[model samples]
Target: MNANFAERLAELPQYLSAHVVLSMCALLAGIVLSIPLGIQAARRPRLAAATLNAASVIQTIPGLALLALMVPLLGGRIGFLPAFIALMLYSVLPILRNTIVGLQGIEPQIREAARGIGLTDRQRLWQIELPLALPVIVAGLRTATVWVVGAATLATPVGATSLGNYIFAGLQTRNWLSVLFGCVFAAGLAIVLDQAIRLLEIATRDRRRGLAIGVGVFLAVLVAASIAPRFVPPGQAGTVAAGESPGAVQNIAGQTVTIGSKAFTEQYILGALMQRRLEEAGARVVRRDNLGSTIAFDALRSGEIDVYIDYTGTIWATVMNRSEPAGRYRMFTEMSAWLWVEHGILTLGRLGFENAYGFAVSREFSEAQGVDSLDDLSAIAGDLTVGGDPEVFARSEWTATRDVYGLGAARTRSMDNTFLYAAAHDGQVDVITAYTTDGRIAAFDLTVLDDPRGVLPPYDAVILVSPQAAQRPGLAAALGPLVGAIDDDAMREANRRVDLDGDTPAGAAAWLDERIAEQ
Candidate 1:
């Protein structure tokens, strides 16, 4: 396990590096903008109150939500810029409030004495006031440091790489080690940064030592920032792509392929597999990871992305808006026809596995209640609580599930997907909507309720490409080898490596590619 942990650590350099740069840039942006805002507000009480209130409001918006909101604002694109702006906005409040407080907290006598000595108002502020207020300002900087460093993890969802990638992928795959490693790493980085800021604030109080110490301080920061991302070396860099998941590339002998993925462990793995294969077949590859489930479809249609994988059931319920329960073959047949007709999107082929949606309970709860299936769950649904991603409660599949299984009275909680397993395992919810291949079912000793009535639609993973992408030379040949290439055991194992064993998605995908290549 320790060797596995070490190997995983070897894969995180780029992610760790990107996290530091993003966090620091956001902090720098906040300091550059908010300090001046604070200065002006301090002299005007009404302005100060309004400014503080506005910053406070920004802080209240959830980090992920704020990042997502940047998509359309930046003209329907996502990546470092949108994420950077959100981080800067989030970093502003603490710095702004503390700057105002520091400015106002100065003793009247200090300014009076400077004036008595013929110092101008501006002179007093720079010489006597700002220096005195430095400590408090730095205290705010420290708070902002901790805040941005921690929040930067959310960048992964918006298609920016960060330490959060490990946490998000791990939670979905039911990988405790991966989750713990990410949490510990992120927390460790935050503490080190805050402490360094504290030291800087202290060193600057004395002019003589501060000058020499400042160089060391910057060197320390640069070294610390550069160190984390350098661990995994070069080629192993996670293929998260850069700058809005890229549009298209011109490499691979002028052939280009864009691969996109939804925000889940399986999607990340699948996207990487697709990207790697296409690249091998002499086409340039672009990866758009962590896209919303629906966003993947739209991107493919618009040709913003050239390739991705989606489930049959998700397409049936969310995209096609059909309510009929059909066999896997029928559903795919109809879905393929509907997509080609409606949007000119093409379904290349099906990956040989079903990552189906179902209900699950802890082994303890299942055995105690003797609940073996959805029917059994339905019988006691009135007393049980269910947990899932926020989308599940409102989706057509869930509504039909409730109607068929008679689970309408069950208490429900909507939360981030990563926490559902913990919620169920810890008894926060008695049942959570579970994915069939989720590694946690075995690891955490939980039972998945049988969907005997087939309330949930069949979910066969399929390769989807835009009409434009499908026209590329050798595109079908590049992608054809993947059909029926991976089975349930293989995908579940790959997912487990990401979710539980702490492997990065690229590393996991690379490992899977090796297995397929050997065959």
Candidate 2:
């Protein structure tokens, strides 16, 4: 009943609806695709081996990676399409396997009897073979139901709204309530769907027409309820109107803008900031948060998102594939030009802050070991274990830093960014690739080692506007004032409010807005 919990609860209908629709659609598609393939495969041993092996291989792929791969494969399309495809593929294995088993297990006597009665092959399949196989096929469906629902949570990073949003955002902001809410609801949905299918299974097996009818009706209602919200008019029912305040800008009224945010606390705070600013400018804003780094940029390029915050170094290193170090001013200038020239993405200038990746260690360790720079750490590298978020180790920056600083001997540990600081603080990791603006740096009294070689590029926080969005009336003007508006200290404090003080991202954004206003 607290405000934080209430806020999350209010978002439930939106999140749950999307979650339900995605899960159900993916499950239904899997069933449709699998049943036919299973029938064909059941008839031939070679085909059965090929189809089952292919599905098993798909199942072997990690869910998150499979979903991530879908984004690029679908030509950078995010949200529902890619997520649905990935989940459908994931749902195939169990259902297909069960279907083949069920059909093949049917008694030869029953099939022979049907043939003896002058029943055609098709008629035998529809009347006799399928009826006997119904229970097993339904069991496969039940398993698929559980899997698709669980895997659907990982859809958040690919820009699909699901219960995974709760888990991803919760983990970043350390909000256990949100995490629990998503898990409970997702599990509940899986159980409910599984039980509903169980009812149909029983009815089919026992020849109970009424029970079958009731289950059919229940599913129809569930699907209807899940998709009903999509039909609601904007600014009505569950929708909140933009620019309702007295100070709202008139020119931008009714213009819709979509904002993207990567999966992390700072990104969430910045995203909320942009959402509020655009709303104040009389623009209806939609947010796609918890997106992966490349996914966010791709979404912006495709005009799926109007604007989002990104770092100059990320663009230089990842997007442009440049490993050479470029100073702050030169890097920003070149990167901005490249964005516009290549993809028409407009850089709105830096926000006077940098969230560069820095190697950090406990202050006590820094003092005791006399490690004040990457040079110092290099000498003792073999004796230490370095931890970082999964992406960092794979990045060119890390590769450059490692080669330059002779850190090949150091042990590497990959973990969630949320756990990096605590791991280093508790000596579970001797060092971590810490974001410079993270509030935990100060809170944990960690000392960031200086990079004497300048191998790591500067990561100046910059706002990027999509090509189509830049042409919107009053949009650029409304966002113009935010350029060079915030400093590093202010950003760090705002992040601290969310990461340590248990404030919501919106709350932290509000505090940041007030702080920026006073300046």
| Best candidate (score: lDDT) | 2
Instruction: Name every residue pair that clashes in candidate 2.
Output: none
Deviation from native of the Cα of residue 87 in model 2, angstroms: 0.4
What candidate 2 gets wrong by more than 4 Å, as runs, is 230-248
lDDT, candidate 1, equals 0.80
Candidate 1 local Cα displacement, residue 27, angstroms: 0.7
- Clash tally, candidates in order: 2, 0
The per-model lDDT (C-alpha) reads: 0.80, 0.90
Measured with C-alpha atoms, the lDDT of residue 460 in candidate 2 is 95
Q: Which stretches of candidate 1 lie over 4 Å from their true place?
A: 1-3, 112-118, 173-177, 209-213, 216-259, 262-265, 282-306, 319-346, 361-376, 389-391, 413-430, 438-454, 466-475, 484-519
State the lDDT of candidate 2 residue by residue for 229-268, as single tens digits: 7421242111223323333356566888888999899999
Candidate 2 global Cα RMSD: 2.6
* lDDT (Cα, tens digit) per residue for candidate 1, span 71-161: 6566545557778999999999999999999999998988788989999988988888889888889989988989898999888766677
RMSD of each: 5.7, 2.6
